[model samples]
Target: MRYLFLLFMLFTFQLNAQVVADDFEGFGTIYSWYGDDCIVDANFLNPYQQGINVSNTVLEYHDIGGQYANVQFDIDTTYDLTMNNSFSLNVYVPSSGLTGSEINQISLKLQDKNIEFPWMTQSEIVKPIVLDQWQTITFDFENDFYINLDSNSLPPIERTDFNRVVIQVNGENNDDEVLAYLDDVLYFDTVSNNPIYDNLVWFDEFDGNGPVDASKWFKQTQLIAGDSWANGELQHYTNRQDNSFLDNGSLKIVAKGETYNDQDVTKDYTSARLNSKFAFQYGRVEVRAKLPSIAGTWPAIWLLGKNINEDGGYWDAAGFGNTSWPLCGEIDIMEPNVAKNQILATWHWDNGSGYQINSNSVPSTNANTSQNWHIYTLEWSEDTMKIYMDDTLVNQMDSVNPFNQEYYILLNVAMGGSLGGDIQPGFNQDAMEIDYVRVYQETPLSVQHFEKNKVSFYPNPVQNKLHIDTHQFANTNTKVQITDLSGRIISKKQYAENGDTLIYNTSALNVGVYFMTLSFDNGINQTFKFIKQ
Candidate 1:
């Protein structure tokens, strides 16, 4: 049943959306990739295949002490950055292959390849890299900090002259020898013209000052392991009002430096962990939150599969427990590493072999999460899942296997965990305040009804033919049109004198969602949605 649903989703939503700029797999839209003052092997075999990227082929860049060593690709058409401004790539830089003491960093620059001197007008975003492992990094011109080589140049989103992407390792002008492996270079515009998720289904506004709504949230206070939680966290999650409560119209999950004992275990710090009672298949989740800034604090807004066989989870208590941890899937919408001042979004699942994770990290929008409130969003659909920070896309991955199942939400703050290194001395208390959490799903298609005209249609999920009856207004001239979800017209016709029935041959239409409209000469129009199977 699940596999059939997955196939249905793929057939219904698959459209011509070009997001992968290059992956070196013979399927990328871009065909012109070259190097500037460097050596590039476009069809090199993968040397390290254990980490995030494990493709058979990759792009190997070797900068043998060139002054301006980089790899670049050019497109024939200039990009409208205001619409499509997000780009990402997976990079692996090994310390054994590097020669100089330059900082370990990768920079992605956008330039006008047609210009005589592209470097003078280039805009670049630099990200620090790890030495031995593969890491996926995103460059969001609309969100990340960028530098324009020419001071007089406008911001990346305001310009429309970018036709080339240049990727450089370490500082370019220095005589530093660096070797890096790159794959899955992607570019996309997060905005959707025909959004499926538009109807709000569930929400929590944290209205009054008191305990959280019992019917909507469950406090998971039971200890999972022997004496501590997973990941070496020092916090004992409790249901006490001091730990989780509503104050001043906001939900506050507080962590304090106090000795707490629960379930025969004692911890020096205490916090709250909440599991939303609601579980959903696929939808859009929006959370407006202000994070805790203490060095030892790890605050997260995440989701876990409803079938996860966790003892203390809300869904588990409700008899939906079966699958294990990574196989059940995990989606981390927002997790803040306070020490690094960065926000990480990740997806974990089993890819028929072992645990696989796809992740991306971006610097906090304001460099201080506690000082500002930001809206973190997760847009999940049949084909893809996207995570956004204040409307700027930070991460995107294909929807597969475990992600097709239902999942519930989890919000918590842990202290001194694996990701959170050490506790700050004399830290008393800190709170993560959340304004609201809202979930939205796609609106179902309405029943076709035209009262005055008395129009009707058959074969909604049409394969090759559609039949419509419009004999009630026989004397009136009407126009019929069919369009795709993006408002691109597909077919149009005019009926001079209305007949008893009209037939449309839809064999040429693609297998996706489309709209059909009927417009009469009397200024009356009606539209209905249909699917071409």
Candidate 2:
């Protein structure tokens, strides 16, 4: 019976095995498999069909929005296509200049017999197409599939049925100019429907034997007297090798108590700060580094906005009175004060009510961070922002609003801030060494199915407290039983409600290994292993 049930579930998955549309061999011909099904429709636009003209640049093909035509096609399959499926094609554009609102460029739509405006997220305007290039464009239709001027806000399982797929050449673009060319169109199964962080973006591991990649990083070279640039912060910015160096396979940002002045203070300490030349919207950002030691010194790895105050430009804004700093928004991924060896994850935003800080902190036992390296991370997304020390989720943003716009990562050592005022008078030089920084997006896991099974918790290596997040299975009648490793029941408790979140007070339990079992009404059994220190 168990094997039969598993088979039924797998069959119900409905794996996508059909190609909804395609024009391989560079638009030379359209062939259908399973015999004698060669067909063409007037609604589909094929530039190579001699009805439209396209120009090729050194990079890819190009066409004006209003001037070009649209593309369309219909498959024998109806609108029942749902999650785990995808639509894909390749497009090559030369120019990197385009407006964000131009819908005539690219669009995908699904409609009933009416074809009225549907809810979906259309493609944003991008740079003009380059010449003689191949740009592969894959559209994941599994996640509520979107179309031009429409937003897909439906759940995955709810929006799987549709009747049409429409691609267009013009939208919100006044310049009805030339038409764009396309080729090699195919749709298949996708692991997930997320477009931005689907685990295929390009990135470097920073493990080479030389300097950091010049194409990815840009160094800041500025020395303002008092080195004050908001946060009422202290420390002079320098480009010296001693202050910041890439040696023995790591990047170092050093802070010291020496000074020089161009028009301000001439004597103090110096350090280096590095910023990326590129900007990222959302991803998992991780930094592995060793903190520096100095009484008043502060070391940090964080991110900043790209265009907070863009009128004066990038370099000028870091010089004070040029642009209001934190007002634009700040994501402090990791900040360790000299007074403590621990790291904190926090967010600062203006809510019509000045800048407020929301943060999470944890203890450090690695002997004054300056001695060994630790991995600090900031997991950012449209709905959540989190901080992690190594593998532990230390602090998370309370409201999930800190990451709505574009933000660039930063790794620097500041002498003082609102928290760094404790910098002692007799301070010399110190350094923060970083192995590398990496970013990623989490794979979406199925929560609905995971909650249907029995849940259990186990004995743990603990000296303080143990809690179970029973809220996961809120609709089932469940009971938890705790026992010694030798099959001795210590306690049995029932929840008031299905998922009434219960806490097992460990105040009286002795420090030792134990076992826990959870039995569900469906006859499913679950167990876990834990420890008590």
Candidate models: Cα lDDT each: 0.80, 0.52
- Residue-by-residue lDDT tens digits, candidate 1, 1-533: 01111111101112354333566665466677799988999889989874546566789999999999999998877876665667877899989989979878899999997889998999998877778998777787865657788968988999989988999999777998999999867675433222467789999999989999999999998887777788989999999999999999999999999988788878899999999999998889999999988889889999999999888888998999999989999999999765757899999999576887878877785657788889999998765788988865667776888899899999999999777779999889998999999999876641122223455666655668877666544687778888665546889988776565667789998665556777778886655545565
* Candidate 1 least-lDDT 10 residues: 1-10
Going through the candidates in the order shown, the clash numbers are 0, 45
User: Which candidate number has the best lDDT?
Assistant: 1
Choose the strongest candidate by TM-score: 1
TM-scores for the candidates: 0.61, 0.44
Candidate 1 overall lDDT versus native? 0.80
